[model samples]
Target: MTIIEQYGWNTVWKDKWNGKYREHEGRDLLPGRIIGDFGSKFRVITETGETWGELAGRLRHTMTDSGEYPSVGDWVLLAVQDGGEHAVIHGVLPRSSVISRKAAGNTRDEQIVASNVDTLFLVSALNDDFNVRRMERYLIMAWNSGANPVILLTKADLCQDAELKIAEMERAAPGVPVHAVSALLGDGREALLPYIRSGQTVALTGSSGCGKSTMVNWLSGRMLQLTQDVREGDSRGRHTTTHRELFVLPEGGIIVDTPGMRELQLWEDEGGLDLAFGDISSLAAGCRYSDCSHEREEGCAVLQAVAEGVLEEKRLLNYRKTQRELLYQSSKEVKQKRKSAAAAVKAGSSRSRNSGWRKEMDEY
Candidate 1:
């Protein structure tokens, strides 16, 4: 099959993207897919396999400061320009799915991790860097993205014991499948082969030094990129992959490689929290109070489990922490939107009043 056939974008291109989209009275343009990026520039591949394009200044002006810009795997429209070296992106097509996070630190903007992803591989190393709490954070984001989440427990060779580590992760993740693989030795790597089938799209993401790039190289059967061992002092790896990129596996599957992130901030995914702490949710449901906070509430089933030793305190603490973080983030986003809406209303009212005065002056 051709690129369109393999990517399943042919029909999408025909029905939704073939012509200009004039939603609410806007003009139209030709369509393309954002395949990669280079600082402030984009590389969009059209449905026809022609690649390398950039966004026009006019299109950039139309973009609201907050809406997600074109990310890898996003379908976009372009006005084919004069240069054989370039084309201008006019607009971004509707996205089916996107995995995102608030850009690390105090930035109030959401960063797109990847778009239109079929599966999310949450890679975690088996070394000292592995943290169950961190895995929980990844799971919540994956659940919110509407993509299936698969846990990849990498670097089996580094760990002294594999079974114990796997069991701990499984306990935290509950129903999720956890696979242990050693990129260095290739042990247990076969378990992940079935997922690399032709036509499927997967993305690799996790903390720095989790062997995500190594796994990518292993899958491609060549040294597609460089790899670095974790620092001996802290056991954290340096950021090797600088940007998000879509790579077609020689075997069959498509995978998006992402830069290692020490920080994966959560954005607006309430359901993700529910799915991540499902056990906690189930327990909290039986609380006498309909709106129980699960903190110091009398006759709380969640607390009862903790008292009975069925639930670990650390698990409950992590659940509460994640819930609070999401809640805070949601509240912050709401406030920002409210302030923006008020400003927009004020601006629109001013524009309307100005237009009325201008009409009167013209009549006189």
Candidate 2:
């Protein structure tokens, strides 16, 4: 058993990944989390913060093999540098949960928000930053990541009354915990610390100006980073936190904080849509046909609910919109994946043929 298994990192990622664990074990490779990442380099922290470092060539080469690139919350195989603070990251283990979004500005592929997380603290400042639809998008992505989702409404003091907002959040996120907190006021912050226990990993994601950095500073008992206030013209805050980073909570456990996302688009997780639009699903099951479209159909239970005030029509529309978006993304990703696979196979065959020709010429 590896030290990660002993320390519980292996247990968290065992079922989610299958990699060269036994080969990479021992003094060379240790388990570490990607805390701070720029474009090419990343800052990693293991149980011993002293061993923190960056990735090696092999891991970088293999990153294109799948969607297992290192993110802030990733548990990676680290090759310790014998004499310096820098260590070489050899490989990335599997992730039990991964939160992602369609990278902004018409990117074909998705961007991994965080990985290997146990809990997703979906932060939303209660001031002008709150939006039910936007919250739903994050909630869907969180649920799709396979982590337990909890809503953290920060800047609660800024809102005139939080009860109504909390109520709305509860409605928007059914069966999910909704807590309004103020990092400045120190109110309702304690309620969330239980989940930040030792050995587990919690990831925080929300728009900029949501006080994620402030929350991290408060949780860690020191200033981890800086923060800024929202503008007077708009309730939306400025981008104080720029990158996604991991931090060790002073109380226990680990936390990953991300820069605010002004534009969060859906990716390929449909289970999230099913869970988020559960009311629509439940209503649809009662539809007369097995494959009911729930639109203008006479026996559509969903339409009936919309007419009878049981379900909001807008809610159903959003569900369909998200579902269609998911389908479209999945289809597009599959086509791209097939194209990549075909290209890889063709390249490999060409390389093999070239090597054989070279061998024949050498024998001459």
Taking all chains together, each candidate's TM-score versus the true structure is: 0.92, 0.90
RMSD score of candidate 1 (Å): 2.5
Tell me the whole-model lDDT of each prediction, alpha carbons only: 0.81, 0.78
Best by TM-score: 1
**Model 1: per-residue Cα lDDT over 214-312, one tens digit each:** 988988887876898788887899998998877778767878888998888999885988888889889888999988888898989999999999888
- How does residue 40 of candidate 2 score in lDDT? 74
Instruction: Find the 10 residues in a row with the least total lDDT in model 1.
Output: 19-28
Off by over 4 Å in 1: 8-15, 18-30, 64-66
Tens digits of per-residue lDDT, candidate 2, 1-364, equal: 3433323365536544445463463554556767676767887766566455666676675784566678877777776675547778777776677888887887676788888788899888887788887888888998888999999998888889899999988877789999988877788867987788777788888887777888888888788878777786777777777788877676667788788878788877858987877778888899999888787777999999989988877778777777788889888889988998999999999999999999999999
